[model samples]
Target: MSRQIQSRSYLIPIHLDENHWSLLVFNINSKQIINFDSLYNIDKNIAIISNLISILSKYVTVLKGAQNWNFFQNYSAPRQSGDIDCGVFVCQYANEVHSILNMKQFDIICFCETKIEDSYPNSFYKNDYYYKIRLDRSRHGGGLIIFIKNSFVLTKSVHPENTELIYLQFRKSGQLNNFIYTFRAPNLKEQLFLEKLEDFIHSINLNEPLFIVGNLNMDFSDKIKSNISKFADHNDLINFVKTPTSI
Candidate 1:
């Protein structure tokens, strides 16, 4: 199986019992065995993961070279809301993981009653992307991640030391130099959110071709909209979208 698939990672789905489904991923490049069990904790599944690793190591040791396997039970895979949904979550997570690893931009946001924990579905894994920046606060309902193409030669120019804002500088070969900022403010405290963001924008090189985007979460009637405009005017940036993104 290792020789057949020349990928650094492989997602293997297995049916455990009549109703339960789980996933096992072999990350050969990282020498890690990533196990995903929706119903069980990491410690509970370590034995199963260890046994599987031992069996596979025999066939792969000769073809893929010898290495020690590190067991990682993904507690981040979605917990099943119902017994039947485990299979569905596993399929979706696997697809998302494969897409992100292969560098296909998947913009669809999947929401469910169960919290999704796998980093691949969120495109958080540093795979084939050349330059990636992530400002993650999964608990706070605010996070931003950017993936630059591996073909692009990027030089970090304006990375802020703050997590609330994502400011990156990149220069693509034979392409115009660009500055990108992805912003996501708090839903409730709009005043302080814009103030900090405005301060951040003031500190960066705004004269270049700048692309600023994110889930600002600011309503047209909200006072934060006015502050956003004020900041835009001060920095000569344009606010192109006015419609409410959510229904």
Candidate 2:
């Protein structure tokens, strides 16, 4: 059974007395069996998970050689509002962990139209692996959030007031370029938005490598001939999203 396992971390769904379900994460890297129970019943579920770990550890020791396994229970996982949703919560926890693991491949991740308000604290989105920066939505429509890997030493630049833009400047970070600008254009105030965006673009240092990303909300069709395209062309910027967003 150990030979069949390829991943460094694996999940075990434990069935409790044919009625309830819980999850056990065997993280080989950490040498710990972490338990995630949607019910959050520490007194009831801890002993069951520990006994299962004790039984499983014997097989693991025999197959992979003698090893010390730590048991971690009462993990801060989401709890189910009703009794019938334990299985669904388990699936959600698995998917969330998988996504977090996969996110290790990218040095930076950007989110647009987040709809997150300014009242939320930075700790709300905190992760041990990445430094999170959030730009609150000016109006009720959209917000921006950026996650940069902790390995890089970077500084954020001042953005235009009352507009949806986040400017980050990286210094002495090898292979990573100068700046990253993320924005979400307003659906209303077309001309005002364009004017501000154009002004911001013009202020950028042409010598440095700059990446402009996020929703521009413009049709790039040849027949439409949008001002957004003209702005891009004038600045010598390329549109990488080739496919039409909508029919």
Candidate 3:
């Protein structure tokens, strides 16, 4: 017996015969029933969720409203290290799903010249709802950090060697890749900086959207003074900052 629920998505916790716990996230819009199991026991977990979905499909309301709903087991979900922690993993997975469904306005945040030390503990700026990536200054007076909403899955984080830049790749619910680059130029070596920056830009895939941000110490108004403009033109990057950020 299924009751009609009027929600865009549903989160259901499943107990595996009182031994293990898992989560089922059903999105009515996508018609996807995703299983997040800490154990990653595909055969057993899929069987359980499939049985539940089959039962739900038998309901007149669900059958009429959503037909041929697909079931997917998330293999990338964090697995529990111990046998007794499946319950905790289930709760965390449910919370993550909740955050994804009700996301905030800002998905990505970047900071340059953060002056953060390598030894600095992440807990100082850690937000439970966001993923934090930090790059400490190599010499002095240069550091970078980025915070992305946990709702968006982080596919990769790339930090180029001998450079003050960090590139992060993210995806939202199986969407296309999103690349974000954060950089801060050193006070000296202007030519070397541009050359290295150009190399980094050349490495990126232009088909996907790439956001390059940070304090480059260049005035965008002056094309010659700001060598970045040339690189931007070469790489087909646009400067969204129309107004002067500094005098």
For each candidate, give its TM-score against the true structure. 0.48, 0.55, 0.53
Runs of candidate 1 with Cα error greater than 4 angstroms are: 1-94, 100-124, 138-140, 157-163, 173-178, 220-225
| RMSD from true fold, candidate 1 | 15.3
All candidates' lDDT scores?
0.56, 0.65, 0.68
Residue-level lDDT of model 1, residues 89-180, one tens digit each, is 66566765546546444322222112223343544454664455555444313445565666656666454665355565666656555555
Clashing pairs in 3: none
Would you give me the overall lDDT of model 1? 0.56
Model 3 agreement with the true structure over 1-247: per-residue lDDT tens digits: 3345466666766656445667888787888878888888768656656666666555535444343677788999999887766655764676644354244445776655554567767774657778888888732346676778898888888988988888877888777574655554435566677788788767876567777777676767854546778778877888888654422
Error of 1 at 225 (Å): 6.7
Tell me how many clashing residue pairs each candidate has: 1, 0, 0
Question: When superposed on Cα atoms, how far off is each prediction in RMSD?
Answer: 15.3, 13.8, 18.7
Two-way lDDT contest, 2 vs 3, winner = 3
Residue lDDT tens for model 2, 1-247: 1134346676766655434567777777777777788887657766666666655665554324213567677557788877666655665666654355355766777765554677766765577777777777633346677877788777655556877887777654464354545554444565677778778766766576777777666777777778878877887888776655422
TM-score of candidate 1 versus the correct structure, residues matched by position: 0.48
Report the Cα lDDT for candidate 2: 0.65
Instruction: Indicate the worst ten consecutive residues by lDDT in candidate 3.
Output: 96-105
Task: In model 2, state the lDDT of residue 222.
Answer: 74
